[model samples]
Target: MSKASETAPSNLADIDSSAWSELETAAVSQQSGFRYVNLCSVDAEAKPQARMVVLRGADRSSRVLEFHTDTRSPKWLELSANPHVTVLGFCAQTRLQFRLQGMVELHGSGSDLAKAAWVRLPTWSRMTYSGGPPGDERAFEAINESVPSRLADEAEGEAHFGLLIFRVRMLDWFQLRRQDNRRALFTYDETGALAACRWLNP
Candidate 1:
C-alpha cells in the first residue's frame, strides 16, 4: 500500500486537507499519480472532450489549480467557449479518487500569467509549443526537425503557450478499501471558502 493509504484521513476536515495537500504535492512531483490529470470540457457540438494535462500549480487556500497548454489546441478552444470543466485524477497505489468541478480562466500569450508560466518552463518542455499546431498532420521528416535552441527560437514557442487557471467549486473525494469504501463531497463558495461538506455512501 502507498503511504497515502496507510495514513488515510479519518475525518471530513482532514480528508479535505489531505486532498489539497496531495494535489499540491502532485503539482511539483512528476512521479506522483495525480501529476497528470484528465481535464474535461464541452465542445461546440455539446460533446464532452477529455484530455490529460500536467498539474503545474495547486493552491489550497484559493482552491485553484493551474495547467499549461498550447493556445492552438482543441481543448483551448473548447474551454474558451465553455469555461466549465471537470478535473479528475486517481491514484492506483493509494486507492483514492478526486473529481473536481471548476471553471477555467484562460491566460493568453500576452497575459502576464502566461508569460510567467512560460518563463518557468524548461527548454525541452518549451520545445513542444514551437512545432505546428497540435493535432496537425506532419510528415515524418518534419517531425524530426531540430528543437528550439536559440533564445529567439524559444521566444516563438512562448507565443503559443497559455496558462489555465481553474477555480474549483466542488470536490468529490473517494477512497476504496477491501472491506468498505468511503466518500465525501465538499462545496466551496465563490470566495473559495468551504460552504458545505457531506459524507456519502460508497
Candidate 2:
C-alpha cells in the first residue's frame, strides 16, 4: 500500500472535520470527474433500487444535497413514500467512494429551489425535461425516441421540470487499496454541527 493509504484513518470520526469539506469539494469539482452519483431508494417491502443521476448542488454549510429528476419517475414515488435514501459516488482516479444516507424533500415544479436548479442546467441537459412523463408505457417499435429538443430560451418556462433536495444526516468515505482498505464515517448532530468521525475496516 502507498504511504498515504497506510496512514489513512479506518474510523470515520478520525477523519478531520475539514475532510467533509474536501469530500464535498471533490463531489462538485467539474475537473474531478465525479459529477454523477448513484441514488438508492427503497420500496415498501424494503426492496432497494438504484439509478445514476447528475449532481445538481450541495450546501456544505447546511449539509444539503440536491439533484434533479422528473417528478413522474417511479423513484420519485418511492422517495415520497420513504424519505430515507442513500447516495453513492466513486472516483476511479482517486480510488475513493462516498456513501451518503439522508432524508429527502421533493420540491414541486415551480418552487424557488426548482427554479434555481433549472436555471443552472445547460440546454443539452434540459432536453431530458422534454420527455413526456418519465417511465410511461408506450407501444413497441416507437419511433422518434429522442427527447424533444428546445431552444435555450424556452427551457425556463417548462413546467414539468422539478428539483429534489436531500438533507444528509450521515456520510461514509471509503478509500480502496490492494492491502488494508480505509473507511471513515461522519454524521451531523441534531443542531447540524459536525460530530466526531471514526474509522472502520474496509
Best by TM-score: 1
Model 2, 1-202: lDDT tens per residue?
5565556554444464434555567556776535787999998788999999877676777788778888778888899899899999887766778898889999867788787777777776666666457778766656545444367425543576767888888888888899667777788875557775667667
Q: What TM-score does candidate 2 reach?
A: 0.81
Each model's C-alpha lDDT?
Answer: 0.92, 0.74
Worst 10 residues of 1 by lDDT: 144-153
After superposing candidate 1 on the true structure, give the runs of residues whose Cα lies further than 4 Å from its correct spot.
1-3
Off by over 4 Å in 2: 1-23, 26-28, 31-33, 138-157
Assess every candidate by TM-score.
0.95, 0.81
Per-residue lDDT for 37-91 in model 1, tens only?
9999999999998999999999999999999999999999999999999999998
Give each prediction's root-mean-square deviation over alpha carbons.
1.3, 3.3
